[model samples]
Target chain A: MTIKNRSRITVFILSFLVWLALTHIGDIQEVIAGLIVAFIVSMIAGKFLITTEKSEHIVKRFFSAIIYLFKFLWEMVKANFHVAYIVLNPNLPIKPGIVKIKTDLTKDSAITVLTNSITLTPGTLTVDVNPETKEIYIHWIDVLSTDVEENTKLIGGRFEKLLTEVFE
Target chain B: MIRVIGMAFILIGITFDFFGVLGLVRLPDVYNRLQAATKCVTFGSAGILFGVFILQGFNNFGFKALIGIAFIFLTSPVSAHAIARASHRSGIPLTKETVVDQYQEDNELKDN
Candidate 1:
């Protein structure tokens, strides 16, 4: 099979597994219905679902993505505690402002992951992206610095490296 | 033992949710509120769902809880981004103490 066909098959299998896990239906009729649904959905949408150019290292990418997920969970927990502390403080010491930071990631998927990671983290939100310069505008609850390099290191430093490994 | 851990998670989740609500009420503006709400739902609700999963163990209900957690994790940030972008575009003024305005600079450059 061609690489695209293989990926579509992979998508179909993954989606079918997810459907089975989610529905957990043992009835034969329901199972048959689910199989039909999963096949149809995958056939219609699989091409758009997974489109990584580097399909050779699928296993390596999957492992790194799993590790990245655990790291993301840790970051999420830390962010929660950090924001909770700031919110619960008597003075509410927030210095909200927008800062511009550059990202070296070129792919649309990588950029989306970076922005979503930033927004999900407690104290920062991605306000905009300058596609021409690959600069992201982030609204940070704590305006630590105006320096571009400093802000980039602060915001994208953790996930950007891992994401580069995963996507690029 | 699992029950104890689940209860602890539930308690922590409630505390986070309470503070999130407090932040919503006390914060100065829309952006800050988005920060609180997003974190609250992501961490707070996820924690609760996780606790439910643990309490139920490997049963069907537990699987549903896991699905709920995944759904929340995937969707919360997108909605928050939508709201933040909308508020920013509609010219919602930042809090008085905001130190910088890079977005405005970009807009000016676009206009010129």
Candidate 2:
């Protein structure tokens, strides 16, 4: 309804349309059709779109997110090697269980990134996020309780914080 | 050269798809399964797009691939978050080896 909201919606739609056009450009006719469809879909979904502009220092947050992503990627590479080793060995050394880990991030996006990044890892899975308790119930192939909070800190304090700086 | 790249992309995409499905079936937990599917599918899908680009050079196939990849990137986490939230809300006990929880601020905020 407001100019800001309308602008947000338009940007969102355009971004989506661009993505579609770029991905599906098999033919001229198809690309044109995709554009039409994207336009139609956005128009239909316009009413449902909620644009609440929260301040997240864009430049600062962008850099932070980049750093976080870099760290996460590195960690994933290492985790994969470890997981691969476990897989190759006849004895699967994975002692799996779900553990409750608390989060410290205040923003929804920050928390989302943290949990998703956790899911991205090989041995660890983000099983659940308790709304009431605000804790993450994660399933780890290998659990080490003494370092649970610390590990979460590593997740939240390190990556989540950087993500917050990027997107919050 | 273009055709070669396209073929490579297609081949790689197919392989990633295989890995994605394998991870989904073989992985023990939902989270791990999700990781495999999301990551593998994403990478595989990218390969497919690359192959398409090689063949078509930025047309409809590219658009479709990009759309699918972006949608997966945006939506996968959301669904994962929803599933995780549901599991957590339902009060499932965590694995025995978990060492720490770092979400104290969130808990305290709820208390407040």
Candidate 3:
């Protein structure tokens, strides 16, 4: 079967299995319930989530997204320590500042993920995102430089690249 | 026997947690350190919490443990991203051991 068909089939099977486990229904009943629910959800998903423009890019996008997510998870683990050390130290040796970071990403979902990710760590908050300018304003617990160019390059640049690999 | 098993898992989990702490202190860079903290603490805490849950015999405490695990998974990644971005923006230079900086071209375009 084609990948698309297989993905759908896999989704069906998985949903059926999850339903069985979650509801503790018999197999036949599980299949019926799962299929009906899956069909309804898929229809809603197609209507609300999938666009014709995206449909063509869906397969390539999905795989790439998974790769990005794994990389992102790794980065997340790393950041936790950075924040932890910052927290544990008595000096509270943070140089806090607000900076504007410019990026190439304009996709809504990706931008949201990027912004939310920024907000999750200990020392930073994503205060604003501007798509028209493709920029984000971040409040960093430490601001080592006032140079706009340097700050922009540091904040959004690396993430924009990784996120590009992941989402765009 | 059950108590022994519970103790074993909790200690194993706590050991992992300490390893995560050590990783936080010792890893050479921001990226590497996060790796140690996220995976180690996640599994460690979950292991300990699950041990507690099992020991408690699936009471409300068990439910809370599961929820705690879920919360850790969700929040950990986002927080890490935030810290990294903040560091970079603050001009906290990455270790010399590091190389690539991808957002340069894109940033240039926005400035213009």
Computed on alpha carbons, the lDDT of every model, listed in order, comes to 0.85, 0.62, 0.61
lDDT of 2 by residue, B1-112 (tens): 8788789879977876676776666655554556566656655666686677568755666556656665665666567657655655565543343344334334457689
Off by over 4 Å in 1: A1-7
Of the candidates numbered 2 and 3, which has the greater TM-score value?
Answer: 2
Per-residue lDDT value at A126 in model 3: 63
Error of 3 at A11 (Å): 9.1
Instruction: Give the Cα error of residue B9 in candidate 3, in Å.
Output: 9.4
Consecutive 10-residue window with the lowest summed lDDT within model 1 chain A: A48-57
Best candidate, lDDT-wise? Answer: 1
Per-residue CA lDDT of model 3 for A1-168, tens digit only, reads: 444555555565555554554453545776677779976655444233322142446577677777766765565555555555654566645554456676677678778777755554334456455678777766555565656678667665546676775665
Best by DockQ, which number? 1
- Reference A-B contact fraction recovered by candidate 1: 0.70
DockQ scores of all models, one per candidate:
0.72, 0.26, 0.08
The CA lDDT at A89 in model 3 is 66
Clashing pairs in 1: none
Segments of candidate 3 deviating more than 4 angstroms: A1-46, A52-67, A120-122, A146-148, B1-112
| Descending-DockQ candidate ranking | 1, 2, 3
* lDDT comparison, 2 vs 3, better candidate: 2
